[model samples]
Target: MLVALAIRDVVLIERLDLVFGPGLSVLTGETGAGKSILLDSLGLALGVRAESGLVRAGQSQASVTAAFQPPPAHPTYALLLEHGLEAEEEIVLRRVVQADGRSRAFVNDQPVGVSLLRRLGALLVEVQGQHDQVGLADPASHAGLLDAFGGFEADRAAVALAHRDWRAAERALEAARAAIAEAQRDEDWLRHAVGELGTLAPEEGEEEALAERRQGLQQGEKRAEAVAGALSELTPRDRRGGGNPAAALRNAARALERMPPPNDSIQPALILLGTAQDALAEAETLLARLVQEAAPDPRALESTEERLFALRAAARKHAVAVTSLPELLERLKERLSALDAGSGQVVALEAAARAGRAAYVAAAGRLTERRAAAGASLDAALSAELVPLKLDRARVTVALTPRPEAAWGPDGQDRVEFLVSTNPGQTPGPLARIASGGELSRLMLALKVVLARGSPVPTLVFDEVDSGIGGATAAAVGERLAAVAARVQVLVVTHSPQVAARGAQHYQVAKSVTGERAETSVTALLPAARREEIARMLAGERVTDAARAAADELLAALT
Candidate 1:
């Protein structure tokens, strides 16, 4: 609940501090007694737009501070926690407006932006006026209000969860469909590439091995020519059939052995001839082995060269290194496999999406049914309140219309609106259009009375909600305000003595001139002082004996 309001150099309120208590409190004074200024100051503290003109004539700045003590469950606590600010037992919101029209805001003495202050203010208090610019007047908030009144938070949450799940499933289905479409677009190319790569079957480092083998074969061909020429020289096919140097050397040694006598020279010559024959035979054998080993088959050399060139051509065609061809092959094969299985995968995704949608529809259907029932009950309750507020002819209706699929959301499929009919046999219309200003205030009051139990705001301020009505109608308004105050703190700025008399606390706003400066002050009236103020309201400029007697009667009736 709002505990206090302090104003400094704001308009006519030069300096004032007013402490507020729970229950209905009425602020009463003559016209232009700065009641509006008081509300303006409160609005400033609540983060309303600040103006330089609000500063007093001799002051450089204007400031307003509002103090509140809200319960733990109030939304302000959550807002405080969200901003990384401590939620103390008491919360203070202050706004300062400079002479240059600049302003600053603070919550619990921690500097904050005006936007945050306004947000927190909305959750802490709801200011309703005859114009109905805030709170229930907004059509966007109607659904949330209906849900709160209907106690359908859990049902609504369930529907929200289901909606999220349905959306996620839809996204998954879309992604899978896109993947399959892309794969299908390239299906033929993928299959052909896979087939080509499979046939080639290139391995890592196979290029190097093939190149080495080809080089060895080319070198062997050259070496074989050289070895054949050398062997021909040693053992040429000439006129003497397959004669070699070893045969010639052996003939020489035999001739030497036959002609040798006991001469030393002849003996040495025989020995030399024998040694040359042995050396020539060894050379001939070695040459034959070399020629045989150097010979390479032309078919094998052609095959190795072809394999090496094919590997290089495939690598260039695929825009990959020879070593990476195997990996690329595996990847293409995987895409092909996925394409083959895509139909089944798409079917599974579609089924999941369908299940998700079904679950959401079921949850929303149940919630809509319960909301309709609750709306009916709320309408009946609000209608019961209308008769006493002098709107016995007015009827309230909760309109629940199914939203189109395109407009459906987490809140469910129904759009809730509060409709009203002021006279019998007339079609009900929206609340803002169906009633006069006074009637609308009363209607809002009736709704508040019925819906107060679900309201999270700790304070409600009604500015002249009793405008242009008096007598029993004003009394009815007072009664309703009192009833609402029983549940939460209510501050009403009014001129109706009956409404003022109904207050658990009464305050008188008065203006005075001091040293060429005008100032507005708020005084919490004692019982006797309250009677005089109420009498003043009843009697106008002059307080009459009869008016005093009526005020006393009014006070006595409350007991």
Candidate 2:
């Protein structure tokens, strides 16, 4: 419930502090006396758009602060908990608007976005003025209202869970289908690539080994040709002077042995000839080994080239390197497996979706039954209150229409609308469409009285809701508002004496002059002052004895 409001430097309102309690409170004043200003200030504190023009004529800024005491289950508590603020303590909302049209909001003195403050404010207080009832007019609020009235909170929870489950199953089904389709699109390419890679059978470092072997063979081919040319040049036929390198080296070594080692020149020549013979023998052995090993077949070389080119082509096709062929093959195998396994996954998802649908149907069916019963009960209760509020001919109907597709909401599969038929032979339409603003306000008052018995909001503010009502009906409206106040805090702005007289707390809003400056102020009325204010409301500027007597009677009746 809203407990306090403080305004400073606001238009017409210089500085005011008003404390409210848990009962119907009235703010009564003559026209143009800033009654609406007070409410607008409260609205600004409640996160309404701030206008720079609303600042006091000479001030740089305007501010309003509202204090509320909401229960643990109230919406403000949840929001505070979400923001990691203290939820159990009192909630203080402050709004400051600068003359430049910029504004700042604070919750519990912690700066927050205007949207956040507005959301928390909604949970704390509901200002039921002319333009503030769009939520009530919304179709979504109907099922929620019904749920609150029918005690279907548990059913609503179940429906929400079922909807979540259905979405989960739907997501699973969609994933499986997408996976299978993607795998199918690439299956043929995968198979062909895998087959080609298996045939080629490339290994790590294969490229280096093949290139080294080709180089070795090419060198061998050149050396073998040189050896054959040397062997042919050393032919044993009569045309050559030396039959072979080995024969020449052998003759030289024999001649060197015949010479004695004592003569210095002959000994040196003998030693060189022996060394030459040894070297020639080594060369012949090397040439023989090369001839035996250099059997490099062209077919083998061509095979190597073909395999390397195929690996490269495959790598390019898959946008990877030859070294990654093995990994790509593995991926291909996995994708095929996923395509095969996806069929069974789709079946499982379908079953899960069916189960979720069944659960939703059961929960929605139960909630619908309860809503129907609640509608009848609410109709009976509100119907009884209607006649006394001068709406005797208007029938308030709580209409619940089922839409299975729409039923997929957190509340369930139904759209609830509050309809009214003012008289006989009139088809019921939406209350806002059928009734004028004044009539709707009266009806809303009746509804407030009815719903206040079980309200989630902690505070209710009605601005000029009693505008078109007077005499007995105005008194009745006050009586009903007071009845609602017994449950939650009620704040009303009225010009009617009967309503003001019925307030447990009466406040007089008036324009006053202080220090040669005009200002608007509000003061809680004392017993003697309240009587005079009520009399003023009755007789305007002329407070006669009869108006005072009428005020006394109204106060007496309220007591």
Best by TM-score: 2
- lDDT, candidate 2, 512-554, per-residue tens: 7778787898989999999999988888899999989988987
C-alpha root-mean-square deviation, each candidate: 9.4, 6.9
In terms of lDDT, the best-performing candidate is 1
**Cα miss at 454, model 2 (Å)?**
5.1
Clash totals in order: 0, 1
What 10-residue stretch in candidate 1 is worst by lDDT? 131-140
- The local lDDT score (0 to 100) that residue 248 gets in candidate 2 is 81
Tens digit of per-residue lDDT, candidate 1, span 1-559: 9999999999898789999999999999988889989888998988889999999887899999999999877788888999999989999999999999999999999999999999988888888876644676656677777888888899989999999999999999999888788889999999999999899998888988999999999988989998888888787467674566766777777776777466667887778888887777788789899888778897989999888889889989989988898889998998888789989988999999999999999999999999899998998899889987888999999889999988879999998888889999989998888888778888888988998876688799998989988999899899999999999999999989889988989999998888887778899999989999999999889999999999999999986
Measured by TM-score, how close is model 1 to the native structure?
0.71
Q: Can you tell me which runs of candidate 2 are displaced by over 4 Å?
A: 81-88, 131-135, 189-335, 404-407, 453-455, 513-517
> Local distance difference test, per candidate?
0.88, 0.81
State the displacement of the C-alpha of residue 303, model 1, in Å, after optimal TM-score superposition.
24
Question: Per-residue error at 103 for model 2, in Å?
Answer: 2.2
